[model samples]
Target: MNLTTTAKPIVIIGAGIAGVHAAETLRNEGYEGRIVLVDRDTQLPYDRPPLSKEFILGELSEADISLRSNESLTALRIELKLGVEIVSIDAKKKIAISSDDEILEWEKLLLTTGSSLRKLQVKGSDLEGIHYLKTLSDAKAIRQKLDGIQQVAIVGAGFIGAELASSFKKQGKEVTILERMPLPLAHILGEEMGEYFLQLHQSEGVHVITEDAVVQFDGTTQVEKALTEKGRIIPCQAVIVGIGVIPNTFLSDKELHVDRGYIVNEFGETSLPNVYAAGDCAMWPYRGDNIHIEHWDHAVNHGKCVAKNLLGGEPISYTAIPYFWSDQYDHRIQYFGHTKNWDSAVLQGNMEDKQFTYFYLNESGVIDAALLVNQPKNALAVRRLIKQQQSVDSDLLSNPEVNLKNVHVQENEDKVSY
Candidate 1:
C-alpha cells in the first residue's frame, strides 16, 4: 500500500479511475516523483457506472461524476494533459510518442487505456440514434436524446444493458432488453441464476426479450426501430448496445503481447520491462485462466498493486478475488470468484422469495463462486469460502436454521463485506 521512490518521470496513460487513483496512491505512499497524466478525453476522470443509473435518472449531474476537483488536481502538483492520445510506446527506448508528436521518455510507464464498448455488428449501427455508454460524452448524448422518449431498446443482458434497462424503467420509459442467449447473464451467473434475473427484470415491468438478436435497425437517416432476428419490430427512438467491451490497445504492438487486451503477469508486468498494464486493458491470470476484468473495482485495485511493483516494492502478486456488482431497479446483484469449475451448488434462501445467495461449490466442496440478490451480507462469508478452500457442508449453507456465524466456510468467517 506504500511506495516511495525518487524516480524521474512516471507517465500514466488514460486518466481513468485506475490511472488517477494510482497517481494518488503513489503520492500517498510518500513518492515525490513527477507524475504526468495523459488522457484522450477533454474532461478529467469520472465514474462511468452512474452514467446509466443515477446520472440518467437525474439524481446526479455531470460535475458529480468528476473524481477530483480542479483545486485537488492543481494542489497535487501533477501534470494533467487532457484531450491527448498516446500514439505508441517504445519500450526499449522507454519513451511514449503522443498524437501531438511530443515524445516523453519515462522511467516507468503505466498503461491504463481501459476498454471500448462493443458495437452492434448489425445494419444501421452507425445511425445517429444508436448509442453506447462508455464515456461521459456517451452519457451526455443519451441524456440529451431521452427527452420525452417513450421506448428504449437495450441490446445485451449484461451488467451495462441491465442497469440501463433499470434506469430507463425508473424514468417511465418503455424499456425492452434483447439478448441473444436463451438465458440472461448466463455466461456470468449461469443459466439458472440468469433466468432469475430475467424474472427480476420482468417483475420490474421491463420487457425482457431473450433468444433474440437485433438483426438491423430500421430508419431512413436515423434509427426509428429495431429489427430482431425473430422478425419482430420494436419501436424506439434510441438503441443502446451494452454487449460488453473490447480492450483499447491500438497504441501497443506485439512487443507487449497484446491479445484482446495487454497480457500481464500476476504482478501486472508486461513482456517489456519498465512497462506495466492494469485495468480493463490488461489480461491477468484468473482461476487458472488469463482473463481481463472490465469491472471498475478490479481496475482500481489492480492499479494499486501494479504501482507497488513499479516502486521497487517486495514481489507481491496481484491476486485479489474477482468481484462485480450490478444495480438494477431496486435489486443489486454481486458475484464473486469463479463458477466455471463448480460441480455443484448450494442454494441459500428462496429464489421465489426474491432474496437469496446461490453459492457454486466445486467437487472438492469448496465454494468457488457466489451470486447474491437483494441480500448483500452473504458475500462476506462466501468470499471467505472461495479464498480458504474450505469444505462446505451443504446443510450449513442451505439450512435457514443453521447459523453461518459459527460456521467457517472460508479462511475467515469474521471478514465483512467490502
Candidate 2:
C-alpha cells in the first residue's frame, strides 16, 4: 500500500510501548505519510517492565530503559508530541482535540491509551507515604522514599507487589505483603503454585500475611500503621498498593462500541471506520472470547499488528500468543498462553526444589498454558506445546527423566484423558 506524500498524518495516542511500536512499524512498513505520536507524559517513551525491578533497585538509569532516543525517532520521521493529550475525538470528522485545544486531522487514528493504576479508597488513603507503581515518576518517588523508611508494606500480592517486595527485601528493609486471598496468586495460578510462592517469600525472611484486607490506614501525615478487617494491625512507615489497573477509555465516545474495554475485531479495527485501538485499552477477539491483556509483549505485538491494518490493504489478524515473565528473589517466573479455566494442573518437578513447570490442560486434554519457575531451558518447548495445542501423557509431563521436547504424543498413542 502506497501512501502519498500529501496524505494527512496518522495520529497515534499514548506514547508508551504500543504507540511507539505502531509508529515504528508504520515507518518500517514503507508508509511515507506523516506520523504523529502524542503522549501526556513529558519524558521520552521508556520500557515499563523495569519500573518495578531494575529501576526501583537502582540497577538501571532513566536513559537505560528508554525505548528510543529523540535522534532515533527523528531518523524514522516519526514526530513525537510529548506532554500533550487527546482530550476528545470526533470520529465522523476524523479529527482529535488535544488538551491544549489543538485540533489534529488524521488519515487514520490509533488509540493505545493503555491503563491506569487502581488506587486504594479506604480510610487514610490520602496519606503521603502510600504509593502506586505504574510509571517512571511513581517508581522514582518510591525509590526516593525508601531511603528514610524501613518497614515497607505491600497491599497486593500480584506481579507488581511481588516484584516490589523482592526489591525492598534486597535493600534489607522489613518487607511484609498483605494479601486478601487465602493464597497469593491462587486465582490465577491455583493454590498449589500460590503456596509455592508463599514459601518462596517466607524463606527469604519476608513476612507473608494472607486472608486479611486493609480496611484503614492510620497516620497523621504519613502512613504509620494499616488496620485490617480481622483486628490485625500492621505497623509500617510506607505502603505500596498494587491491586490492579483499569483501562483508559475516557476519550472514547458513546458512539464507539465499549465493553470492559474498547471492543475491536481481530484486525484491531474499532467500531468507527479508519479508527483502531490496541494494547490494554482494547479488547480483541482471542480464541472464542474478547479479552484484554495488559502486558508489555502483547502491547508491542498488538501495536505492530494494528499498524499493518492502518494502511488500506489486506488486513492482518492479530494471533500472537500471550507471554509474560516476573523476576523475584533470584527466581524467574515465565508463563506462556492464557487460560482462566483449566481442568488439571500437572506438575513437572518438585515445588520444594524451586524449579518446576506446571502445565494447565483443558477438559480435552490439550495444553492450555504452562508456568515455568527457574526452568528457563523448558520455556521454548512449553510454548511450542501450548501453541500446538497438543495433548501429552500426564505421567511423562510429571516425570523428571522425560524431556518436555519429546513429550508430544502423536495420533494412535494412548494419552492421558483429562
Candidate 3:
C-alpha cells in the first residue's frame, strides 16, 4: 500500500484501452519501471469502437482496430500476458494470482478490468446464432455467421444495438430492433431525440418495435425467432443482444471500495494507497456525485491521469469532461458531459433538416451536456460550455438564429445549488 514506491513492476489487469494506455503513459512520464499487462483475451488489445460498426460491416479488420502495434509494445517494454486471467488479488501483499496459478507481485496495481456484456437470460439464449458483440471474437463470430443470413433480430436500442442494426442494414441484411423503451435511446436522449433515432433506423430500412422485451428465443439449434412479452414473434436468422454491461468488480477487496465500479478518488487512487482503477471499472467523482463513465475517451483520459498521479507528483484531478460519439447511417451523434439528472433540454435547428443540437440543462439551469447530430463544430462549442459549466438562457439555446459560440453564459440565480 506504499504509494510512493516505484521499484516493483506495475501490474495492470485487463489489456483493454485503459490498461494499455496506462502502461504507455507511465513510460511517457519517464517511469522506467517494469510494466505487466494482462488480459483473458488471447488477441492483441484492440480498439472496441469498431466492433459493431466498421468491423462487423467488413470495412475494418482486427489489425485495423488494434490500439497498439507490436513495435510500440516492445518499445514501451510492456510485458503482455494475453489469454491469462488474474483470478484474485492479494491487496495486502500486492500480488495477483492468475488462472494458471502463477503469482505476480507489484508495487502498484491498476484494475482496468472494464465490464462484461450482460447476457440474455431467457430460454434459448444459448442457441448458436445468438450473439453479443463485446469482444473481437464476438464480432468475428457474427461476421462469419452473417454469411447468407437474411434477417437479424437486435435485442436493444442502445448505442451498441443501434450501431449493429445500422451495420446489418448497410450489409443488406434485414434488421429488426426490439426496444423495451417507448423509443430508442429514450432514457438517455429523451423522447424526441429517440424518435429521431427511430426514424433514422426506419429510413435505412430497419424495423423497430417499442416497449417490447424478448421473453425467449425460439429455434431448434440456432436462434430463428424472438418471442416478445408483448405477444409478438420476430422472425430472424440471428439475434444480437445489446442490453448493456456490468462492471468487473469481482477482484475488489476490503481495502478497495466497490459500488457499481471500484470507487476511486479524483486522481484515480482507490481506497488502497498503491492500488488504483480507471475506465468502466472505476467510479470517480463528477460534480459532487460519483459516476462511472464507460466511454473510450474517458478511458484514455483516466489512464493518463492515473499515470501522472502514480508518478508521485502533484496529484492531477481526473476531471476531463466525458465525450462520446456514435455513427449510424448518415448521422454522427456526438455527445459531451454526463446527463444523469438533467432537468430540461433545448433543441436548436430542425430535426427534419438533418442538423440539430440538443443542450441538456440541470435543474439549476447550468448546461450539463449536449447532443449534436451531424454538427461537429457545434460539438466543440457545447464542450466548451459544459467545461465552463455555463448557464445560458434556454430560449437562446433553443433559438436557431443565435450562434451558440457567441451566446454568453449567464450567472443564473441557481448558482448556489452547485
Q: Residue by residue across 306-373, what tens digits does model 2's lDDT show?
A: 99889867889998889999999999999899899999889989887889899999987788888999
Over 71-187, each residue of candidate 3 has an lDDT whose tens digit, in order, gives 889988999989888989887888999889999999888999999988889988898899888889999999999989999999999999999988888888999999988999978
RMSD of each: 3.0, 2.0, 2.8
TM-score of every candidate: 0.94, 0.96, 0.95
Give the residue spans of candidate 2 off by over 4 A.
Answer: 2-6, 408-418
Please list the C-alpha lDDT of all candidates, in the order they appear: 0.83, 0.91, 0.87
lDDT-based ranking: 2, 3, 1
Report the alpha-carbon TM-score of model 2 versus the true structure: 0.96
Top model number, TM-score: 2
For model 1, state the Cα shift of residue 96 in Å. Answer: 0.3
In candidate 1, stretches whose alpha carbon ends up further than 4 angstroms from where it belongs are: 1-7, 409-418
Tell how far residue 166 is off in model 3, in angstroms. Answer: 0.6
Lowest summed lDDT window (length 10), candidate 1: 409-418
Query: Which candidate would rank higher by TM-score, 1 or 3?
Result: 3
